[model samples]
Target: MEESKPMLRLKRTLTKGNLWLYILSELKRGRVYAYGLSKKIEKEFGWSHGLITSYVVLYKLENEGLISSEFEGRRKYYKITKKGSEELRKAKRYLQQLLNKL
Candidate 1:
């Protein structure tokens, strides 16, 4: 059995308006499997949910056309789409504005 880990999902670190931004940023690094993504999130962001939660976010992104996935061997790898990159740009702009305001 796998060991249990204490981590919160990406959503927990971001506002509802910015959840996808962080996810897309990670994807920008390269395609990643769900479990791999989750672990990276936990290490980098210091919070990540379980495997099921990670998959749920992946499915949502896939449905929204912000990301795509493919099966490679026994794992499914996910990558950001053009739309996702655009959204990431928007998020960066918004963050810049917010920082400037403060």
Candidate 2:
């Protein structure tokens, strides 16, 4: 029998800003296009994200200098910069601290 909607686990949907860590972490893996980043987020973290939101965050990060992007033909690939790495470390620590309190 097919599972009913109530019996099925809902897909985890994340708000736009919630993706900072996922993007940064994936960028650490290598440079990534915004589309690829969003797919990886869903695949690895089970968080469903919209393409426009992901690109918005990407542009924000780039503007903040936490990430840099380059155009290869029509694709823009992003990589975390040193500052972004520092921020990622700080974010990890914050998460750790939050978990410890729970």
Candidate 3:
């Protein structure tokens, strides 16, 4: 059966928009490598969309300058940038406003 519009939107929001938020939130703690990110999200958030999806989001975030990465030997670790913190603050405010309205 086909999904409803709201359900589709929820799926998209959770998978994409919120994935970005979650990644940024986790990075707030400290730097984490790609493989470790998947595990950390699953443990902290109780859900993960797999490594491929996380990597895609990581690449987009890096490209947008929301996060930066450094090589630790063969592994790459990611940390949030100043711009990323500002964006996260904006998102928090937006979410608070939306919640208040609800």
Each candidate structure's TM-score, on Cα atoms with residue i matched to residue i, is: 0.78, 0.82, 0.85
Q: Which RMSD values do the candidates have, in order?
A: 7.0, 4.2, 2.9
Which residue pairs clash in candidate 3? none
Worst 10 residues of 1 by lDDT: 2-11
Q: What lDDT score is found at residue 28 in candidate 2?
A: 87
lDDT (tens digit, per residue) of candidate 1 on 14-99: 63334456578889999998878877776877765667766677788899999999999998899999998887888899979988
Instruction: Tell me the RMSD of model 1 versus the true structure.
Output: 7.0
For candidate 2, the per-residue lDDT at 41 reads 81
Best by TM-score: 3
| Best model per lDDT | 3
- A best-first ranking of the candidates according to their lDDT comes to 3, 2, 1
**lDDT of each candidate versus the true structure:** 0.77, 0.84, 0.91
Segments of candidate 3 deviating more than 4 angstroms:
1-12, 15-17
**Which residue segments of model 1 deviate by more than 4 Å?**
1-19
Clashing pairs in 1: 8-48, 8-49
Predicted structure 2: lDDT: 0.84
